[model samples]
Target: MPSSSGRPNNNLLRALSAQDYELIRPHVRCETKAAGELLYRPGDHVGSAYFPCGPSLVSYEVTDGDGRNVETVLVGREGAVGGIVSLGFLPAYCLIVVKFDGPFVRVPIVNIQSAKDRSPSFKNMFARYADCLMAQMFQSTACNAIHSIEQRTAKWIAAAMDRTGENLVPLTHDQLAAMLGVGRSYTSRVLQAFRQEGILTTRRGALIVDDPDKLRLRACRCNEAVKEHFDIVLRGVYPEPDDAAVA
Candidate 1:
């Protein structure tokens, strides 16, 4: 009995043609989730795909043997999490957690499959999104291997800011360290350096980006590389920050 009204704020859903969107419109429902809420864990069957709206964000994290959860990719309003191109109720491979508290559009996997089966364009669009997502994962792997902690930190902040359209990131030093798969001290040093450069400031549980352009200058090209792929594969689907929000 979940109700949905008005146009979806998600970039992926907004990119769909009127005809294609209507196919899944009736089946989609709206829900709000709090930050740090776990939507899916490893081995859980993914029955629905959640499309974040506005500044909502989700992340895929994998736990290592040492019990550290390392983030792989962050999905915001630009795309979706869970069962994008999968068939039936497939088991999730990683932990999917909500990073920002906001509204999300939920569509049953069956409805998505039905829409894709009926429309080649719908299938192609989702398929392209899957490709773009994979490219992001690949670029993140490369960045982790090649970039310095400082560069990675700046890149992560920039990417988050772009999707949320906000200069303030609601993340703690511990959380950022976990996402980077490094010790807190490493991330702290990077953040301290950024603070010294007047690029950002840290609060009790958040970091505020003071100068986005300066932060971008310190970041590696991994974000840009992934964004370029997204542009080529799904133009206008990637989220861009509003000028006033970032400024």
Candidate 2:
């Protein structure tokens, strides 16, 4: 949800200079989204940009013709999905899916482009955010190629917890398989092992972290690397949920 100050809780928006914030403030509209919802699909024009708030998590995935998708990037309060680098409404190259239930502030692409055109600082901020997003994409590719599924699973679980700011993340093995681009049985097996090791516990469709420090040890280092890059490119734009948002 947006804060009472009328500014979005999203780090990028909160980081905006007062002058730049006002330029786009009137156009921002906050809306709620459910898990498993698709914000945009490949071939669909991106009509708006979404900045997720606490409890909101979006995934950018490369979709195949067969309708399967593998996540390339994760966006939360720290970033936006859709219409960031584009000058106007354009077909999305990847599908954007919300994996958590929460609110997001969306602004039309035209407004975003207009805001950028009118404010040099705004344009520069968008450019830096886009670069930081690209860094996530690159790191994700390498992490998938080099890391074991156990480690990668831990990474994404930790990421989801970070984004949602919850000790309990509502996700099922099937959902995670799609993101990890693995077989459902494989994901189930991995998850079962985690439970056996007392890393986490699951009930219904949610996962509760038991020993986060141990879970962090099982994760690949890509998350830290991506966070460092974001801190460098868009200082304070990456949500430090571990400290600021986590319960």
Candidate 3:
């Protein structure tokens, strides 16, 4: 059973042996995170690490001068966001946004570093998860550059479903547009097309995916490739369904 700290809700924490979890458990604090919360901003000092629990989702945002952030990676209960590989006094290079609402376990980076130093297995696990993160970032870049918006949209939906474990996505077109770094009008049209084909329904600032299989079929192969890499590197530390939940 998980203690009051909520550490066991996250896959990475669960992957640790009983002894390893005890090393970090004392340092972890569970906190509620609302949707749209900016956990880390560009150039901000790293304060702590967050492990999203359950349906909580976070996205890494890469921004340019236009001021709109393009989401590069989507994180779920399967991983931790921010200050993972860093040790001390590091400034965040990318923004971290919470895309879903739930509890998160935060541990001070200093404590995390101390835990890593003492536990060789803990260090190795984090190192492998870091590799998985980098792989997701690279694949997202390639997918955005080469795939159509429609395909990417399907992939995003499929990925979200995997994390949230629900077909109803609580997001508006404008929210998705900002995440995808596209125009609201364009996203609306694309969503409308999706509705027309009986793939999904968009209304009242949320989307209901009635046909996940069809949506997955429409999505680009990028998410699958990322999952394959996770299979090799982190295995169960990543989301592995007989289906897909993202990387």
Candidate 4:
């Protein structure tokens, strides 16, 4: 459900002043989307911006020459995806997919552009979010190059958990492998090791985090780095697990 103020449960929207929020509130629509929904493909013109609400999640993926779709960044309630900083319709550079099933707030790009044109502060806020988004991509690239697969796996799970505020991540081994740009066998081995250590357990189509602290212990600092950047750039916009659920 939407909030009492008729806003979606998106932190970026929540961060906007009442006056600025009203500029676009009347134009926004909230809807639930299932996992595996494709929001954008490379070269496609971006028509709308999506803000994941509640436990919903979205990812930017790039297909490598080997035909592997590697995840670049995950956006949850804390951010928006598509033509975020662009002044007008622009071609998407990556494949954007829904990673979790939940409610999302969709705003046509034209409405957003109209709102931005009316309020410089609103535009600045999104520009800062875009900076934070870029920081995540930068850190992810460095992590993939320097961290071991085991560490990366833990970090990925932790990142997802933080965003959804849930222990169970709805992802299959094959899905995880594709996101990590690795083979299913390699992902299975890392998961097996984590299971043996009592950190997490794998279900038919999900991974349950048995102990978040232990999982964090096994993870690299990439997630933390991104969170820190978000804090500095968009202080109260970053979602925390304890944040109240919108109804």
lDDT winner = 4
Q: Rate the local accuracy (lDDT) of all candidates.
A: 0.89, 0.86, 0.84, 0.89
Tens-place lDDT per residue, model 4, 1-247, is: 5766567878898899999999998888888889999999999999999999888999999988877799999999899999997877899999999999899988999999998899999899988998999999999999999999989999999888888888889999999988988889998999999999999898899999998999999999998898889999999887775564453
Decide which is better by lDDT, 1 or 2: 1
How would the candidate models be sorted by lDDT, starting from the highest?
Answer: 4, 1, 2, 3
On the 0 to 100 scale, the lDDT of residue 100 in model 1 is 80
* Model 3 per-residue lDDT tens digits across residues 106-189: 989888888889999988989999998899999999988999888888899888887767788889998898888788898888
Per-model TM values vs. the true structure: 0.95, 0.95, 0.93, 0.96
Locate the minimum summed-lDDT window of 10 residues in model 4.
238-247
Q: Write model 1 residue lDDT over 1-247, tens digit each, in one string.
A: 1214356678888789989999999998889999999999999989899998878889999999988899999998889999996766789999999988888999999999999999999999999999999998999889889999999999999999999898989999999999999999999999999999999998898999999999999999988888889999999889765622110
Candidate 1 runs further than 4 Å off:
1-5, 243-247
Candidate 2 lDDT by residue in tens digits, 1-247: 6575567678888889999999988899989999889999879888899989766889998877798899989888888898898776779987899988788999999999999999999999999998998899899999999999999999999887776667798888888998999999988998899999999999999899998888889899988899899889998877665644421
Candidate 4 Cα errors over 4 Å, as ranges: 4-6, 244-247
Best by TM-score: 4
Instruction: List candidate 2 stretches off by more than 4 Å.
Output: 244-247
